[model samples]
Target: MTATLHTAPVTIPDTTDQRVVRRRLGPGHRIRFSFWFGPALALAIWSIGSATGLIKPAILSAPWDVVVAFQDQWVNHDLLGNIVASLQRSLVGLTLGVVTGAVLAVISGLSRFGESLIDGPIQIKRSVPTLAIIPLFIAWFGIGEEMKVITIALISLVPIYIHTHNGLRGIDGKYAELAETIGINHGEFIRHVVLPGALPGFLLGMRFAVTSSLLGLVVVEHYNAVAGIGYMITLAEQYGQTDVIVVGLVIYGIFGYCADSAVRFTGRRVLAWRQTLEG
Candidate 1:
C-alpha cells in the first residue's frame, strides 16, 4: 500500500540577508591587518637578519644599534634643535606653496583671462625640476635659509597647483547651472560647491607638497651652513656612522609618515559626505 506521505517543501534561508547585516557593521569585526601585519613582519625579518648576522652592522647597522644611536644623539647632540629647524622650514614652505597654489587655482578656474595669463607661465615653471632651480636659487638668494625655504616652496607649488586646478575644472557644469537657477551668487557658489568639490584634489596636492618640502629641506641643508636632520645625515656620512645615518633617515621617515597621516585624517573628516571604495 502506497501511503500518501505529506512532504514539506524545504525552505532555504537566504545567506544574503546574513551578509547584508555583517556588511552593515563596517570593519568592526575584522582585524586591523595592515596596521599590525606590515610592521610586525618587518620587525621579524629585521630581527632575524640582525641576529643571524645576515645584515652587517658596518654597512647597515642593526636595529638595536640604530636605537642606541638615536638615544645618544637625543642625549648629546642637538637632535631636537635640528628637528625644530627642519619643521619650521617645512611648515613655512608648505604654507606658502599651498596658499599660492590655491589662489592661482581659484583665479584660473574662475576666469578664462586669468587662465590665459597664469597657466602658461606656471606650466613652463612646473616643467623645470625643483632641484635644477637650486643653482639659480643659490645665485639669487645665496646659500642662506631664504634660498632653502624658497626652493621648498617652489618645489611644492607645482603639484598643489596642478591637482587643485584639475579638481576645480573637473566639477560638473550641472551643479553650476543648478546654483544659477537658485540665484546663487559667485561667492556662495564657490563656498558651497566649488571648494568642497576641489578639496580632495587640494588634499592630494598637499601630500605632494609635504614630501617636496622635506626633499627640498634635505637637499638645501646639505649645501651650506645648517643645523637640521639633513646636516646630521651629512655628518654621519662624513664619519661613516651608518647607525647615526639610519637614525637620521628614520627620523625623516617618521616625520613624513606623521605629516601624510594628518593630511589623510583631515581628508576623511572633511570628505565624510563622499563614500570612498577603500577599505
Candidate 2:
C-alpha cells in the first residue's frame, strides 16, 4: 500500500486596486515629456502642416517666420522695453493684490467680529465679476496707468482672499485643542500652527492671483495709451502683423506657465510635510 499526501493550494488576497496603478515617472521625466517632447511634437506638426499648405502661412506664420519676426522686432522695435513695462505693471499690481488680500483674509479668518464686518461685503463683491466693473473703473480712473494697475489688482484680490481665508478657517480643531493644552499663546499658535497649516491654500491663492494679474494687465492694456506687450499686440492687430501677434501671445503663454510653475515649486518646498494625492 502507498500512502498519498494531499496539499491545499493557497490564495493571495489582493490589497491594491490594479486599476489605480499608474506609471510613476520622475520629475525630470515629467518635465521632458511636457516641455521637450510636447513642444517638439507640436513644432513638427506645425512645420509639416505649413510646408504642405494645410495651414495658411498668412493666418498662422511658420516657425521660422516667427523667429525672423522676433529678431526683426528685437532689433528695430522696443521689444525689451515692452517686456519690462508689462513686467513692472504685473509686479506692482500683484504686490498690491497680495498685500490687500492677505490683510483682509487674516482679519476675517481670525475673529468672528472681523468676519461679520468684512466677510459679507467681500462675498458680495466676489459674486460680481470684476470684468463687469471695467466700465465703472474706466469712468473712475479714466483709462490711465492707475486704471490699468488697479484693474490687475482688483482682479487678483478675490482669489487670494477666498483661498487664504478658507485656509485659515479650515485649520484642524484638534490642533487648536492641542495648542490650548500645551499653553501656546494666540500669536505663537498662529505663527507655528495655523499659518503653516493654511500655507497650501495661501500658495494656491497666489497661483490664481498671478494668472488673474496677467490677464487683467493684458485686458487693461487693450484700452487706450499702453506701452506693454499687450499694446504691441494691439498695434500688430491693426497693422495685420500676425507673426508679431503670435510671438506676443507665445510670450504671454510662456510667462504664465513659468509663473505657475514657480508657485508650485514654492508650495512643494514650503509644504514639505504634505503629500500630494494622485487621483
Candidate 3:
C-alpha cells in the first residue's frame, strides 16, 4: 500500500543537458563582414544622397548614372580596352619592381658589404618623392608607356625593398642559429628560410606598391596617353562629363580592390602556416 501510494518519479530535464547555443559573432566572421559592409554602406549612403539631390549630382553622379555610364562604356568595349591597357602597365611595373626589390633585399640581407653599399643610396633616393622624378622619366624615356612603366616601377621599389629587408632581418634568431648548426650555407638558407619568412611582408609591400602604381597611372596618363582608364578620365574631364568621370573613378576603385584582393589571397595561401600560428 505504501509503495503504491509513493508518487511517480518526476520527469525533470537536467539544466546541463539543455543546449546553450552561442549567438555571439566570431572574430573572423565579424572582421569579414566589417571589411565588406563598411564600404557598401558608405556607398549606399552616398548614392542615396546624390539621388535625392541632397548632394550635388553634377559633382558626384548618382550610383544609377554611374551604372548606366559603365554599361555604355562596356557595350562600346571602350572600358574593356582601357582596363586592359592599365592592367598591362601595372603588371609590367609590378613585375619589374618586385624583381629588382627582391634582388636588392637579398643582397642587403645576406651581406654586410652589400647592405652598406646600397642601403644609404636607397634611403637617400626614397626621401625624394618618385612623383618628382616623373619629369626626369619623361625626359629620359619620352612621353610614352615606357615612362609610365618606369615611373611606376621606381615608385613601387622603395616599399618592397624596405619591407623585404626588414622581414629578412626580422627573422627569429633561433632559426638563424639552427640553420647555422645544420651546416646550411648562406645561399641555401636564404632560399629556404629567409625568402619564405620574408614573403608575407614582401607581398604586403607589393600590395601597397600596386595601389600607388594605379594612382600614378592617372598622373602618367595625364600627358600624351591616348588609351587607358586614366586617359578616359582625362577625356571625361575635358568634356566635363561628370558621369563618365565617375564611371572611370569607379573602375579604378574596382581595379584597385581586385588587385589588393589578389595580393591578399596569394599571401593567405603562401603564408597559411603563419596564419594558423597567429590564429
lDDT of each: 0.86, 0.85, 0.82
Tell me the lDDT of candidate 1. Answer: 0.86
Native-vs-model 3 lDDT? Answer: 0.82
In TM-score terms, candidate 3 sits at 0.85
Number of the predicted model whose TM-score against the real structure is largest: 1
In TM-score terms, candidate 2 sits at 0.85
lDDT of 1 by residue, 110-175 (tens): 789999998899999988888998998899999988998888888888889999999999999999
> Residue 218 lDDT in model 3?
68
lDDT of 3 by residue, 15-110 (tens): 544422121233332244344776698898997898688989867888888889889888975788888998898788878887898789889977
TM-score of each: 0.87, 0.85, 0.85
Off by more than 4 A, model 1 = 1-40
> Candidate 2 on 164-269: residue-level lDDT in tens?
9999999989998999998999999999999888888899999999999988877888888558899999999999999999888877877787898789778867
Worst 10 residues of 2 by lDDT: 23-32
Candidate 3: worst-modelled 10 consecutive residues by lDDT: 19-28
